[model samples]
Target: MRTEKEYVQWLMSVPRVGYLRCRKLLEQFGSAEAVWEAPAQELLQVPSVTRNVAEEILVSRQSYSFQEQADFLKRTGIRVLHKKDPEYPLFLLQIHDPPHILYVKGEFTLLDDKAIGVVGTRTPTNYGVLVTKNLCTELASAGVTIVSGLARGIDAIAHEAALQAGGTTIAVLAGGVENIYPPQNSSLARRICKQGLLISEFPPLASAHPGMFPVRNRIISGLSRAILVVEAARKSGSLITADQALEQCRDVFAVPGPITSPLSQGTNDLIREGAKIITGVADIWEEYPDWQANYSHKMKDEAFQLNPEERQLLETIGYGGVHLDHLIRVSQLSQGEVYRLLLEMELKGLVKQLPGQMYMRSSV
Candidate 1:
C-alpha cells in the first residue's frame, strides 16, 4: 500500500497543481488518496481548481507512477516530507507560500528547531569571510544549527565553519537534493549530508536555474529563527533573504562593515533601516538565552577534548586575540606549521581567525 506521503508526492507531480492549488485540494478532500480518487467534476468543485487544472490532474495521474517516484527516493536516500508530516519544518509551515513537499537528503530532523540562516554575496570580501566564520562558529558551538544556501563565498564559509565547530547545519538548495549546483561545492555538500542536511523543494535530478533562487531564498529564511547578513552589495541575493526574513517576521541581524566598502552597502543599509547590529554572538545570545545555556557545557567539553598541541596553541592565543607571529612564537611552532595547524583548528571550530592574520580562541 502506498503511504500518504507517496500520494502527496504523486499529487505534487500533477500539472498546474502548485502549492496553493494543492493546499486547496487537500483542504477539500482531506487526504491525498481521497483527492487522487476523486472525479474530475469533484476536483473542479474545489476553490480555484479550474477545469484545466482538474483535467490536468486526472490526466497526469494516469501517466506518472507513484511507485517509480518512491523507488527513486529509496535509491538516492532522498526523503519527501509532506506539509502535514510531523517532522516537517515548523518554521516553514508559517511562511506564506510554503512548499507542498520538501525533497530532502540527510537529517531533516535537524530543522525541527534552533536554526539561524547566514547569507551574503557570492564574492565576499575578507571582512565578510572573517565575520561569517566567527559568527557561525560561535553560534554552532553554542548549539545553534546554521542554515545557508550552499553557494560559494559567505554561504560556503558559514557551512564549513558550523561543521568545523562540530555543530549541525542545513544547506537549502535551489535544485534537486541529488543535483548539487555550481559543481564546485560537491565535496562540501557530501560532508554536510553526514553531519547536517541538504534540503530542496525541487524533485530529484531537477536542474536549478536562475529563476529558482528567489523561491529558494524563501525556504532558506523560512527554515530558520533568524537571518544574519554578513556582506552584501546593494543588489545582492543576500538582501533577498533578509527581505524574506522580515516578511516572515524573523529577526534580521546585520554586521556593520566599513562604510567605504562596496560589500558593506546592503548590510549598512539594513542597519540604517533598523535591523539589529551584530558585533558578536552575544548579540544573538541576548535573544536566545536558553540556547546559549544548553550549549555552554558542550562547548567547554569539546574544548577540553582538544589534544595537547591544540590546547597549548589555544592557551597561547588567550581571549584578547593574538597576532599570527605571536601565536607561532608563543606556541614554539614553525610559521608554516602554525598556519597549517591554525587552519585545521579553524575547521575544527576550536579557533577563529580574525583580520590581519590574528587568531583567537572561539568565544563559545
Candidate 2:
C-alpha cells in the first residue's frame, strides 16, 4: 500500500499523462500499483490510455525511481499534496480539471472562503498600479486573502500590497514554485513563502513556458470566490483569467479606467458584457453578503440624532462608500471631525461601515 502511494506520486510526475487522464487511469485500475502491474495490453484497455501512452508508461516505469523523487522533495523542503490528500485545496477539487499533484513550497493551509483573485497585464498604467495596490491593501486589511498569478505587473503589486497590509496572500505560479519566473521577483517570492504560500501544479524545477500560463490562470480563478482584473489590454492573459473565473462560477470584477486608455479597454469591455464594476470593496460585499457578515454594520440609538454636518458627510460617502481618509480629503473636513461624524452616521443606520475604516450609504 505504501509503495502504491509512492507509485501514484511517480505517475503524477510523468509527462503527457496530465490531470484528467491520471484521474481516469486511477479509477479504471483501482490504484497506481494496479496500473503499474498490469501488462501493456491491459493498460491499453483503460479509456483514453492509448497504445502509445500505455507503452510510454511501461517504458518510463523502468527508470522512474520513487525514492529519488522523494529524496529530492525532502532535500528542497517542498511538499506534495496528492489529489486524495485531506489537505488538498477543496476549492480546487470543484474545478473541471484539478491537478492530481500540487508541489507547494511554503506554509499552506486550505484558504479561507473570502479569497479574491487579482490579475492584470504585465505592463500597467500609473492609475492601474496605484489602484491595484490600494484596493489590494484595503482588501487585505479587511481580512480578505488575496490570490494572484505572481506575474510582473498588477499581480505582483497585489501580492506586495497584501503583504504590506500584514495580511495573507497566495501566489499561484505559472511554473514550478521553486523556479520563480521573471527572476526579478525572486526576492518577493521568498517573502511570500514566509508570510503566505507559493503553489504550483508543475514540478519543483520546471521553468515557465508560454503555453503554461493559460493553464495556470484557471487555478488562480478556481481558488477564489471572485476575480478582480485591475487592468488588461484587450488581448491580455488577465482576460483569460476572467473567462476562467466565469466558467468556474466565480464573480468577476473589473476596475474602470479612462475610456481611451488601452489598458482600460479590456476592463471596459468586461463591464459592458455584465461583469461588476469594482469602484470599492463594498461593491464586492454586495454580491456575496454572507462573506460580509463579520463586517456588517449596526445602528446605534444616537445615530438618528445627526447634525447638518453629519448629513453632508453621509452624502459624500456615496453608494460604494469612501475610505475614511478619502472622505476627509474630499469632504474637506478634519480627520477628527470625519471620524466623529462617521461614527454618528453608523449609529443612525444612515451609513454602513466596511473593513479598513471605509463607509458607504446604507441601502436599508
Best by lDDT: 1
User: Per-residue alpha-carbon lDDT of model 2 for 49-93, expressed as tens digits?
Assistant: 887888788887898877798899899888888768888889988
Q: Provide the overall lDDT of each model, using Cα atoms, as 2-decimal numbers.
A: 0.85, 0.80
> What are the C-alpha RMSDs, in order, of all predicted structures?
5.9, 7.5
**Every model's TM-score:** 0.75, 0.76
Runs off by more than 4 Å, candidate 2: 3-5, 18-31, 41-56, 110-113, 293-364
Give the alpha carbon lDDT tens digit for every residue of 1-364 in model 1: 8878788777866767755677888889988899989998899899999999988998887898877887888998998888888888888999988887899889888978699999999999876887788778878877789999999999999999999988999999988888899799999999999999999877667677887798899998999999999999898899999999999999999988888999999999999999998866767777777777765636655633667777788889877899998877787889987876776566445677789998887766
What number of clashing residue pairs does each candidate have, in the order they appear?
1, 2
